[model samples]
Target: MTPTITTFTQQRVTVADGVALNVAVGGAGSPVVLLHGFPQTHLMWRHVATDLAADHTVICPDLRGYGDSDKPAATDGRTYAKRTMAADVVALARALGHDRFALAGHDRGALVAVRAGLDHPGAVTHLAALDVLPTLDMWEVMHGTSAAVGFHLYLMAQPPGLPERMIGASADAFFGHFLDGWATDPDAIPADVRAAYLKASREAVPSIVADYRASATVDVEDDQADRLAGHRLRMPVTVLQQDWGTALGFDAAARWRAWAPNLVHNTVSCGHFMAEEDPGEVVKALRGLLSR
Candidate 1:
């Protein structure tokens, strides 16, 4: 089905120094920022954003170099570090007149959301992370065969020019693989949505690769340092993940408890794309977290 271009509040944000991001806003009241996952855009929150917007202002932004945002050049030592990217969200919310907000992110966005809660404990009143572990734990849990599940982790983690060049060669297929592999139900992601995801990802290949590259290098180290220092998530936190007991090895929520103190974890019966496959469940889980 084609998107009818419904009633969405849209704008662009020049956040964190000067990076511009395309943002969609709606609803009114307390603010809640929805951050989409990798290989997807802010549109991923179509099901949940408007509902939350009814009770709280909802802000959705295409991260730095993704979606219709500016594709700025990645300077040496200034690539897409999660910390820097996380700052963009804070700035995005501020750009929309929100100094504090509830924040929820899915998959890659979950990583960013976790970082935001850690980096800006005061600004984020409540936190929700969907379908991901902390970056440090993600890398630490990797083993022989377990590593195979995320080939792109190594691929995109490659040094500088290599990953970008190879990914560019077949950008469509590269992004499509994750789009296809992650969703348990195709209807969960309609065709137009799929097309938008593929289109946004294809155009943002270089920055997307840079984002992943930073995650493997700087992002992982940063999360590790925070963990070593025993800095847990201070805000109310909700984590939604696949049980992963049979597929990945351990319980997903159990691993997350190591980092989040005020935490509630729900193992949903869905694939990694939990938000897309079951947005209502995601919304319910988030409401529960925010209420606490």
Candidate 2:
């Protein structure tokens, strides 16, 4: 029962640096690339992509180090950095003949989308981040008891060997923890799709931890530098997030305002897996972004 979106063609597009991304292209109008988050593949967008395909050329790609994409060894934590992942998708889009495209991502993919907007302003026309804050703002807000809610972030942020070994030892438990905890309804992700995620993540332990490790170190530095230089996402940006800020005692919208000046930020009723739990809302928000 692996979910399938009909009328989509899948292919491997070798990016500029020789990383071949497994991409799914469908629909027939303006291009819009969708990036999947951790513990999932482009399959997470099954519902939304099929719906958007009516009016948009939906491009769904498994982000590097996740799903079927190339998982290069981490060299000084640079391999899995958002900047590097962002470049992969941008190159993928351009190689597919999309010079400029609407971009939407959930979780880790959202981080990449944010970086793509910041790094390649000319290429990403509209930016939508589903269920995440900027890297700097994220680290800044996770404190005290509230920080416990993001325990995995802290765990994966540790030095590479231990985190990789720990997660590898209980790969299913590790990946399944997020799958179970983050969803408002466990059934939002069908059992077959859940199995696919667990299988892919189990095989990608080292690279997966590397992605989070880079987030804590290099990603933070990059975001801090951007803030100091007053660099914000120049394109119209929409953020759909659960109200973790309220539960964690911070103003999420205000925080996003600093990074996205032309921003439309709102809280979603669904938990972290907004795309699966509430695809229609995600679609509406993305449509709003496209209109902007």
In Å, residue 258's CA in model 2 sits off its true spot by: 0.7
- Give the RMSD in angstroms, all C-alphas superposed, for model 1: 2.0
Tell me the deviation in Å of residue 20 in model 2.
Answer: 0.9
Candidate number achieving the greatest TM-score relative to the actual structure: 2
Candidate 2, position 13, lDDT:
90
RMSD of 2: 1.4
TM-score of 2: 0.97
Full-model lDDT for every candidate? 0.83, 0.90
Q: How do the residues 1-292 of candidate 2 rate in per-residue lDDT, one tens digit apiece? A: 2234567888889974657888888999999999999889899999899999999999999888887888888877778889999999899998999999999999999999999999999999999999888899999988998789788899999986888888999999989999998898898998888999999889889888999999999999999999999998999999998888888889999998988899999988888988899999999999999999
lDDT of 1 by residue, 1-292 (tens): 1131247767777896567888888878888999999888888898888777778888888888788877777785456888888898998888889899999998888888888989998899999998888888888777788789889999988877888889889988988898888888878888888898888888888889888888888898888899889998988999888766457676667678888878898788888777778889988998888898
For candidate 2, the 10 contiguous residues with the lowest summed lDDT are 1-10
Residue 40 displacement in candidate 1 (angstroms): 0.3
Give each model a TM-score: 0.95, 0.97
